[model samples]
Target: MTRYLYKELHLAASPISWWFLAGALMTLLPGYPILVGSFFICFGVFQSFQHARESNDVLYSVLLPVKKRDYVTAKYLYTVFMQMIGWVLCAVLTVLRMTALSGLMPYVGNALMNPSPLYLGFVLLIFTAFNVLFLGGFFRTAYKFGLPFLRFGIAALLLISIAEVLHHLPGLGFLNTTTGERLGLQFAILGGCALIYALCTLLSLRASQKRFEMLDL
Candidate 1:
C-alpha cells in the first residue's frame, strides 16, 4: 500500500464505484443470475477508470512526484481492493445460503447458478477477465478505454451464462449443491481459480506498467 495508492483510492475513486459495490448484495437474490453481481463490481471499477479519463487523472498523476509504474500500481491495487471487498460479500452470503438458508425454497429452487464455492470461482474468473482484457487493454493506450470495457462486458456476460448452465450438464450438478457432498471438489475449483486470478492479475499489472512506460505522456 504505497502512499500514492492510498491517496488515489481514498481521494480519486469515483462515488459511483462505491455505490456499485453494493451489487455484491445481489447474492441474496434467487431466480436470477447472481453472478451478475461480480459483473457489477467490475463495472464499478470501470466507472473509476472512466472517471479518471474524464478528469485527466492519469496526466495529473504523472505530473506528481510519482513514477509511471507507481500510478499503474495504484490503479491495480485499488482494483484488487474493490474486487476483494466484493468477494468477501459474496463469500459471506454463500455461507448463509449453505447453512441457515439452505432449505429456503427460493434458493433451493433457483434454476440459475446457486451460491457455492463454484460460484465464487466463477466470480474470480470474471475478475480475471476484467484485469487481463479491460485493465491490460486500457494501459495499451491509456487514453482509450471504451473498447476495452466493451470487451470485458462481453466476456463477463458469457462467463455468467456458462456458470449458470454448468450445473445442468450431466454429472456436474453437484456444482450447485448446497450440501457438503462434493465439498472437496468445490474447494478445489475455488482454489484453482484463486491461483489463476492471482497469477493473471500480477501478469496484467506488469504488462500494464510496461505499456504505460512506453507511452509518450
Candidate 2:
C-alpha cells in the first residue's frame, strides 16, 4: 500500500506537475488571493485523472494486485499532496513578490506585509473548500460520468464561486480582518475545515471503490 501510494505521489509530482506550480506563481504574483492557487491545483489533479484514463493506465491499475479501496485512497492522497505543494509554492511566491515590490517601494511592501486576518482566513477557507469539493466531486463524477475532466472542471468552478461567496459573509467577516487578534479563530476554522475534508475524502474513496466494482471491465 505504501509503495503504491508513493508511486502515485511520484507521478503527481513529476515535471508535468510543475505546470501547476508555475501557474500558481503567475496567478498569485500580484498578491490577488490564495484561491487562485487552489484553482490551479484542483485543475492539475483533475488533469492527472483524465490523463490516466486517456492513456488506459487506469484500467491497468485495476489489474494490479492492489485492492480497489487502496487504489482509490492512493489517488485521493495524491490529489491532496499535489494541491498542498501548489499552495505552498504559491504562498512563497506571493511573499517573495511582496518583498521585492516592497524593496522597490517601501509603502507598497509595507501594505502587503500586514495581510488582513480576514484575507488569510478567506484564503485558508478557499484552500479547504477546494480540496473537499474537488476531491469528492472529481472521483465520484469520474467514476459515474466517464468524463472526469469536464465534470471536475465544472464542479471546481461552481465550488470556487461558492467559496468566494462564503468568504464574503458578514457573520464570517473575521476572515477579512488582519489583527493578530484572531489567530486562534483562524486556526480553529482551519481545523474544522480539515476535518470536513478528511471525511469527504474517505467518502469519495469508498464511492470510487463501489463504482469500480460495478464497472464492466
Candidate 3:
C-alpha cells in the first residue's frame, strides 16, 4: 500500500502539481469563505480529472503489478494527502498574516488570530466531502463512458451545483459561524460527512471494477 501511494506521490511532484499548489496558495489571500470553498472544489475536481486520465492509460500501470483496487485506493489517498497539504498551507499563511498585522494593527490581528475550532472543523469537512464526491463521481462516470473529459465536466458541474445549494441553506453555514454552540455540532457533522464519503468511495470502486472487466486492455 505504501509503495502504491509513493507512486502516486511521484506523479504529484511533476510541474503540473506546482500549478495546483500555487492555486491553493492563492486561495488563502482572499480570506473569504466562498472563495476558499471554490478553491477546494476546483482543486478536487482537477485532481479527479488527473486520476481518471492516468487510470485510462493502458501502459501506465503495466510495469506495476498492483491490483485495480489498490490503484483506485492510491488515488483516493493521494487526494486526501494533497488536501492536507493545502490546509496546512492555508493555516500557515493565515497565521503569518495575523502575526504581521499584530505589529501595526492590534484589533485586526486579534480578530484574525483567534479562529474557532468550529471554523477549522467546517473547513476540513467541506474539503474532505468535496474531494470524495468529485473524485468518486468522476471515476465512476469515466469508467463507465471511457471519456475522461466528459466525466470530469459532468461530475464537476454536479458537485459545484450541490455545493452552491448547500452554501445558501440555513443551518449549514458552519464556516461563517464561530460560536461555541456551533463548535459543539462540528463532530456530529464531521461524522456524517465521513460516512457519506465512505459510501460514495465504495460505490465508485465497484463501478470502476465493473468497467475494468469490460475493457480489452
Name the best candidate (by lDDT): 1
Return whichever of 1 and 2 wins on TM-score.
1
User: Ten residues in a row with the worst lDDT in model 2?
Assistant: 111-120
**What lDDT does the true structure give each of the candidates?**
0.90, 0.55, 0.50
lDDT (tens digit, per residue) of candidate 3 on 1-217: 6776577656532335445655445433333332244354445546544654665543475347867555556666666666666656655654554355324443342312133333334445555445445555545544442354345445545544454355347776653333446656755664565565457656655665565544455
When 1 and 3 are scored with lDDT, the better candidate is 1
What does candidate 1's lDDT look like per residue over 137-175, in tens digits? 999998889899999999998999889888999998898
Q: Runs in model 3 with CA error above 4 Å?
A: 11-13, 22-31, 34-58, 88-134, 137-175
* Backbone clash pairs in model 1 (N, Cα, C under 3 Å; residues 3+ apart or in different chains), count: 0
TM-score quality measure for candidate 2: 0.69
Backbone steric clashes in candidate 2, count: 6
Off by over 4 Å in 2: 9-14, 26-28, 31-33, 90-173
Candidate 2 per-residue lDDT, tens place, 1-217, comes to: 5776677755433446557656565433333434555566666666676566566656667677877556667776777677667656655654554355434443343312223333333344554554445555555544443344455556656655654565467686555433456656866765676566567666666766676555565
After TM-score superposition, the amount by which residue 15's alpha carbon in candidate 3 deviates from its true location, in angstroms, is: 3.3
Residue 179 lDDT in candidate 3 = 43
Best by TM-score: 1
